[model samples]
Target: MSTNTPAPVGSSGKGASLARMGVFTLAMINVSAIVSLRGLPAEATYGLSSAFYYIFAAIFFLIPVSLVAAELTTGWPQKGGVFRWVGEAFGTRLGFLAIWLQWIESTIWFPTVLTFAAVSLAFIGPDQRWDEAVSANKWYVLAIVLAVYWSATLLNFKGMRTSAGITKWGTMIGTVIPGALLIVFGLIYWGSGNKVDINMAPGNFFPDLTNFNNIVLAASIFLFYAGMEMSAVHVKDVKNPGRNYPMAILIASLITVGIFVLGTLAIGYIIPEAQINLVQSLLIAFDKFFTIFHITWLGPVMAVCLACGVLAQVVAWVGGPSKGLLQVGYAGYLPRAMQKTNKKGVQTGILFIQGGIVTILSVMFVIMPSVQSAYQIISQLTIILYLIMYMLMFAAGIALRHKEPNVPRTFRIPGGKHFGMWLVAGVGLLGSVIAFLFSFVPPDQISVGSPTLYVVILLLGAVIFAGIPFLIYAMKKPSWKNTDSANEFEPFNWELKKTNTETSAPAPEQQH
Candidate 1:
């Protein structure tokens, strides 16, 4: 039986430790990585039916991704996350595409989340209208987004310890505490005999699936769960990965889903369906709850927390996918200039390039017809790019099952061999494809201007971003690899097999 040995956690010999992370720490990392409370109000617009979307997405996308990623991570506990896994199944070219999508999607995603953070910061003011004015000011939002994102990028340049510390504390202060408080206040509102705005009728639990446009916003829920697979990259860092990894995933998934469901319901219970604002409702709900509970001062406090949470999230992601792509670059897929690292061993070249893309995307606030339109366009594009990568990942999981069946997996997905792999990865792929298709059908909730223009931009963005990696792969030169780099990304298993086959074959008639 063949087994891929796990690499040391802090393998870079720069005083990094090999200490393993505990299950709780790993679970919190997953929660911090996955949960974002800002999007709850948008989902809350569906009333009680929002529960159905949350649960449906969790089943079809969340659990399957977590489990499948756990198996893949444990099977090959290397540096590159999706890039390493997918490349092993397909080849280096497509593998580079997978990591590229991961990095670039997050690059596009920064502006959207930062927009939420900008709105959150605006709400810190006492006057609602003034806050709304600030939030709506495109230049104001653009300036704050660039400032916060660049700050996070600079902090990340220091190294992982600094980045991870911010992510941990930021999650607790910004996400977990605020989420729990929202749920608590929701319970108080219901228990205090207050009239709930949402329909609690059992019949309303399921969403209207007949109207495709009605469910378009629900498609965004898939993006809410996007970063869970990212946490899987750390599976090998946890002690007893085979046993503890699943435990961590289970705990994290339950916590993540609970926060999402109850948080959305909390907003639905307070804000009327028609009045829910995609960016403002979350804060407004907090304000309303605080007012009723006679703790109105907490509103601004929660706003600060949410803004910090957004920064922490950006901090965590700013370092993650880029680091993976850096590994891909070292594997000869990217030009050597892109592979340069700082003295801190951080990917300086890639970080700067990523920041440049972010700056350009942030500028869309001025060019797009409205701030909301810009938000929707970039958000939809992010969803499409990420879903494309996910499709490749799901397909890779199943392909690896056939190609490397004998490779021992410490945390195999439950069920018979082929059935387990197929069932888990298949559901994830189907959900991703469905979400990808619906993302093109402009959301009914927002004013995205021209529907034709929206579709064209999404298609064009998807093709262009997805095509760039292939272009780089075709243009790759042997000199693009940095031999001086201490960390050497492993060759794909197929490449090794082909090499072994050729080496063992009889020499060409010796040309004697």
Candidate 2:
């Protein structure tokens, strides 16, 4: 049976073929992956020593993930992005799970970041006691964050044109400016001969091989660097993805790692680990670092900038994954309500649902003793979901070689097909497994939650979230395929059509 459902189309009519993206745009996206490196309150506790783990993570985790994504993305530059790539390699059910996990994780992370932004701003308010009160109040923090987050969501509802405008300009104003300011402030502080605690010495910059715990810490921090591939979803929009994709990933990786190495060093120089506000450490570093340099005026300026950056981060995430999952939903994996889009091309329902999820998770903060504990728990759950997505990606990449042997590939991994498959799939599988295992280990700096609770929360999160896709798959019924529906939203169009003449004549020989 042919279902005549019109496929939901995203901006149709291909724009001009993209030329190679230069270092600037590449750096912008890369910065998106690494900007969260600042403050890193968790890392600060091990003294200046944890910076080494970050460097290691940049090497083993971040770069390889980017490379794997570049290959997959260059091969299949389609609307669905990761969901399509993985679904093509695996089946639709698994693909739905990939996007679902990605979308869900972002929802969980929204509150933690907002709280971090709130805490950062609170420090600058007059009266330390009042500052403490505002920072500690869960309801107040939730209200402020929800307000900012929902506003950004509304802006995104205006469509990609508006969202892209904000993202492009916001990245510059929010991230690059603040980052450059940090570097400039650090130089000024050093030139003035102020005593700085964190060592920027050449030897300290190198990875410490002897410390196993620090190695694990780097592995933990490395997970934060996991989103490089997420930006690659836009590779098709880049002028010439083949060359530009690799170039972008390479340049972005270096710039991102450099910023992280330098930024962390600067933070360490200014503050001791014990005094670090793991929640708002980056702003804390700015406050203290600016004070030491006698540039108190810059402190509040940086704080506002940091808050805007966090807000922009929330805005970008609020729309991005939901957009991906909306693709899956409209394709019949989800109900029709999820398919609804307003005039601005936003899935308002999904946005509202995401906010609701975040609001629910925000309540967890009240039960949890500390913001860091709640933040870590939520982030860990996100990591678990992310790992499941990565595992599917790896499997899909490998499956494609066998299933579509002659499919045109613009940018194949350098090795022979088998070698390439093994390398990409193997590394992805290993890194994801390691990341999942490490997700349960409580951070060393603070006792945010008990080990028993942490393990249970993480395990339950992974199982329950990951199980949703399977349930959907089991509910699916086979139907006639529609060639026109190759990338359409309806799965009923996916069933192959049968001809009446062939059906009538089919059993003649068997009867004789």
What TM-score, computed on C-alpha atoms, does each candidate reach?
0.92, 0.85
lDDT of 2 by residue, 289-333 (tens): 766657777766766666766776666668877987777665666
CA lDDT of 317 in candidate 1? 76
Candidate 1 lDDT over residue span 153-239, tens digit each: 999889988877677677778877988999999988988889999999999997778877778978888988876775576765655
> Clashes in candidate 2: how many?
12
Best by TM-score: 1
Q: Model 1 clash pairs?
A: none
Report lDDT (CA) for all predictions. Answer: 0.83, 0.67
User: At residue 155, what lDDT does model 1 achieve?
Assistant: 93
- Model 2 TM-score, 2 decimals: 0.85
Where is model 1 poorest over a 10-residue stretch in terms of lDDT?
1-10
